[model samples]
Target: MYVLAVLSVLHLCCSSPATSQDWPLDCTARKTIPYHSDNGRLFREDDVWNYTTVILREDLGLIVLGTRGVIYALDINNINTKKASVKWDVTDTQQTECTYKGKDQEIDCQNYIRILHTIEDGRIFVCGTNAFNPMCDYMNYTEGQLILQNDQEDGKGKCPFDPFQRFSSVWVEGELYSATSMNFLGSEPVVMRGSPEPIRTEFKTSWLNEPNFVFMDHIPEGANSPTGDDDKVYLFFSETAVEYDFYHKLAVSRVARVCKGDLGGQRTLQRKWTSFVKARLECPVLESQLPYLVQDVFRLCPDDDWNSCIFYAVFTPQMDSSDYSAVCAYSMHDIQQVFTEGKFKTPVTVETSFVKWVMFSGDLPTPRPGACIDAEAREQGIQSSLDLPDKTLQFIRDRPLMDQAVQPISSRPLLVKKGAWFLRIVVAPVAALDGATYPVMFIGTDSGSVLKAVDYPADNAADTFIIEEVQLFQSSNAIKILRLSESTGHLLVGSEVGIVQMPLSSCGRYKSCADCVLARDPYCAWDLTSGQCTAISSAQTQAKRKLIQNLQDGDTSLCPPSEKAKMINTSFVMGSNVKLKCELISNLAEATWYRGDNQLAPSDKHHISRDSLVIPNAGSDDAGMYTCWSTEGIAGHVHRRQEAEFKLTLGTEDPIAPQARSASKGLVGLQVLVVFLSLMLGILVGWNFYKGHFPLPCMQKQRQSSIEDSQADVPGVLEPLHCTEDKTTAPAGNSNNNHTDLANTVPVDGHATEESSI
Candidate 1:
């Protein structure tokens, strides 16, 4: 059983279908829209650092970017031009305050805008790490410029005071729910509600552990819920869990939720969260039994119903030097089940250690301590979360870690990349030829590449394939953010240097039908009417079309049939060089050479390449049918063949001798004289053979006649084994020896005669 399991794993790693990394994707095939300080005029002199955050406002056709000490709004429609941008920078006084805190003036003292949220009434709430002292301001868009609002607010928890600190925030209806360090020294981290009223988690370790936040979003209550069911904000982060007994801190991914309508606890924990609860988010690779650390999460919703939403999280292995990354998906139902049905871990007394932890098995609070206050609870004199009792608030605070971990929808990750660390993920819906909406994932990597892939529902493991891997930046800069613009069909990529906008699909790059089919992209299909590979949406108008696609089975049947071989006959003189041209139409196919039925092996005399065959020093044995076969493997183990055959003939005389004589008169005279001398020489040779002075040339052939008779029925006449022309001429003093040498050089059927003196 162990051997079988090892063999199965080996087969999966070695025999999996090829990914985009195996094929080279042309970067120049797609259009690139770049916006940086070099081209854009809105950038200040020192605004050459990076575009850390990107937010796309589709309705306004704008791309709002956050960088060091500056914020710029770029026109998406005219992103390449300099005049299509507007910028805003922090004041010098704000920079002075940041520098006074002993921060690096060049690096940390600069305003790194980390938060930008779109609030109500076309206004944007912006915040920056103003040299460790975080501050927030409002901006209103006017005639190409963003004017600052006068009301400035404290941005302690909303943005990380240190530029390198990890944080996440989300704005819902005008309030900002954030998870970040609330102090300048970067020690006190908290999850807080920063608007309407200042409510936060307690500063104790039980309430908030040392955490690094990744993402935050709000999930509204269902339409069929009770009257007082409030919307909940979910925060995803990785925190050090204190319940574990290991010497080192164990980092665990967490999913915490808070009710939008929660006021606070009344007495025991006043102005603090009463409904704050968290559960462990488990992302483990089942085959390896290694838990992965959550890096980022994206919420995917098919429609307006938030209940059906699924969270796609990117995770990396918990090794010190790991190269693998995976993408796991969690449904809302599974998350809710773990939070409600799972037990809680509590502290217990132990003599071996100063602190002890164990699973709690006791009665829970009424209506659930972490649950939102419904109409039934309110009717029982519980108006809000503030009315909850001390025992309930203490249980909720002490037991934030669940006994059971929340598992992913699939036992394994949807896709696992071997060499890349995924940083961010975004899904876009693409309409296929079958009229079904398929989700295309655009994942950003830490190596400045964006991988585009499609996940097929029918075959989860085999059908999920990467379509392309695009290098967004020339340098190996990590991709900071990725945002999709459905209106323009472009994906905006943010890196440390600048921002690049690239089209999601580049169907026109694949010029041939086989390439179009082998790509296996859901958005691309070959159009039969226009004879071009085009996007599915553009080809939908065509009356008759063929889509060259099969996600699981790489179907290349849609490619045009290869042309049949046209047989051609050619004759070459002995000791001459010849080249056979095999015109291969498809670049994807492999070309091979064959002589008759057997495959030709590589030799010094015979040369074979992709499209042509060469033979030097033509001989009688080389005068056979030569074939050039073009073959390609598609999908499974199937192979398609295209062939070109040539019938060759070797002769003592040139086949084009008559044409050469007719073209030039000097050539005809020389040929006539040579033929007359050859006849006289033949008569003398026959007289000598009749006289018995010299043995006849046919006499030596009798010894080898038995061996030569077997090849008599062959197509071409066989020549002597040593019938080679010698360029050297003998002197006049040895005329008889020269004549004998010349006679011996003349070849007979399959044998060479010895020289004889007269």
Candidate 2:
């Protein structure tokens, strides 16, 4: 039974064929951008190395890249030109001071630039972990050069002191909101709002417990609010939670928000956030119902308000050894609801001994402590969050975490992968055939590949279709960042080695109409006029453009029919091996075999594979008109067409006989008898003519004479027959049909002769 089970599994793996629906679209990069200098001879000292951050400045047509100890500003219009790069390096004095701090010169002494955010004055704010001592500076563009500003500030919470530590920050309205470790040792972590008077969460375990920040974004005012609300900054991170009953701490993904206008509390939480509230983020797998750990989150919105914003997050299994990863999407409305109506978890003393965390059911403060200062609050003579009463602020500080968790848009993930670990995901809207825009997600994996997919609205939810998988980098380096430029129709891929400029759509990669249509990429279409697969936007102007596409229904009618294949005929001897080959044009189409009108199935004597059909012992029963079909679609309503046909003929015996026989012994006996009867008839006719009468005795005497004459000629015929029979006989185990035929014929001849005489 175990052997049979193993054989069954092996058969499935080996015999499973590739079909058009099951085959994944594969693509390659059009161009690659390397971090190392192309013109090393000219600019020996300048090298754009270790690209940790990539920022695109569309207004200036420049791509600013941050690396260790230096910054590079490349021309976005043409990245290959060497003269277009502007390099800015750290000063020698700063490097000397960084080295004197007893940090590793090679690893930690050099600046690991991590922060690159745009400021209000058209300048860029830059920060780096300067040899474990964080520092910040400004970059201004002037006369084709990026000049570093003289003024510098303490990075602290704005940037991580350790180069390898995870941190996230966002700049909104000239202020930077960041989540990072604020110390050189990397033990003190904080989420703070820096610039224009810095204020942060209380430095306590209750606020942040060993949190690893992933992303930060802001939602502008008056977008989804019925009563115009203040702008809000959202931070996404994962941290060890204290609410679980297990002995070990459980890791939980969190969505923390703070009012942009928050000015701290007046008394109880002075100089600290009064509107900081966080909730758990849940993304569970549909099959296992296990929540995945959130690795990265990307907010897809350009407007000031998050009215149409959706956050796409990459999650992996909680187990470190698991290779599964998934992508989940959360809408702004659901996140807002979780923050507004969700209950809070607060420490409460129960029964006899210990204090435990439970849901707070007491009456909340009047102005809603965790809410931003609104116009009504201003009208009530409350100037800022600072003027709010201590009771209202104390409720927010004590109950930072909500009891309810924020759920994703769908119960299951948008896409799930088995072997690849997704590190980043970005979504962009692409125009479809019906003038409708659909969200296309680009997921970056740790193995240097990107998977592009589209989500379409189905019955009551969305269905995901993976468009293509593209390999951007030759090396298997992790894709740390992915940014899409809608205007240029290109994706900016950043890795530890360098930054890559990849076009979002590679329509020309598809060679056939069926492949183009089956890919289901909204950005691409098969242009019949040009006989090529090209970008949809480029083919829109062609008045006679024939596009073969059906994203929803997967219709392939638009594709041209495959050319008719010629028929093939084969002949094989009985008991010999035979193989019939079927050449299929499309690997995506399913191949099947049919003998005449009946379908043929694989059996012990016959084997059917993806490309060929084999018969171990060819017999007369196997002779038939066989046909090969190429089919698509599901069973019962499949679209099938004949691809090739074969006429098979099986011979009864081997064409090359060992020995030859002129005539069989039975034929020789019959010929001799006919000659003897003719002679006897001649003699009987003469006697009848002479005597003028026919006598029965004379006839019998003539017949006896004819039989004796036939018997005399039989020995001559049987002599050669016996010699031929001796040669035909073989070993006892061998099969000899010649001797059996001769033996059966002699008996039949004797019976016929005896009946004739009577």
Best by TM-score: 2
Number of clashing residue pairs, candidate 1: 0
lDDT of 2 by residue, 362-466 (tens): 888868858888777777778789889888887888889898888878555666555568888888988788677888888888887777877776664345666
Task: Tell how far residue 378 is off in model 1, in angstroms.
Answer: 2.9
Worst 10 residues of 1 by lDDT: 22-31
TM-score between model 2 and native: 0.73
Model 2: runs farther than 4 Å from truth? Answer: 1-49, 82-104, 223-226, 287-290, 302-305, 349-355, 564-758
Candidate 1 residue lDDT tens string, 146-213 = 67775777788888989988899999877888999988887798989876678898888876778889
Index of the highest-lDDT prediction: 2
Q: What is the lDDT of residue 91 in candidate 2?
A: 61
Q: List the RMSD of every prediction in angstroms.
A: 19.0, 21.2
- The local lDDT score (0 to 100) that residue 226 gets in candidate 2 is 64
TM-scores, one per candidate: 0.72, 0.73
Compared with the true structure, the alpha-carbon lDDT of candidate 2 equals 0.72
- Clash pairs of candidate 2? 19-588, 20-588
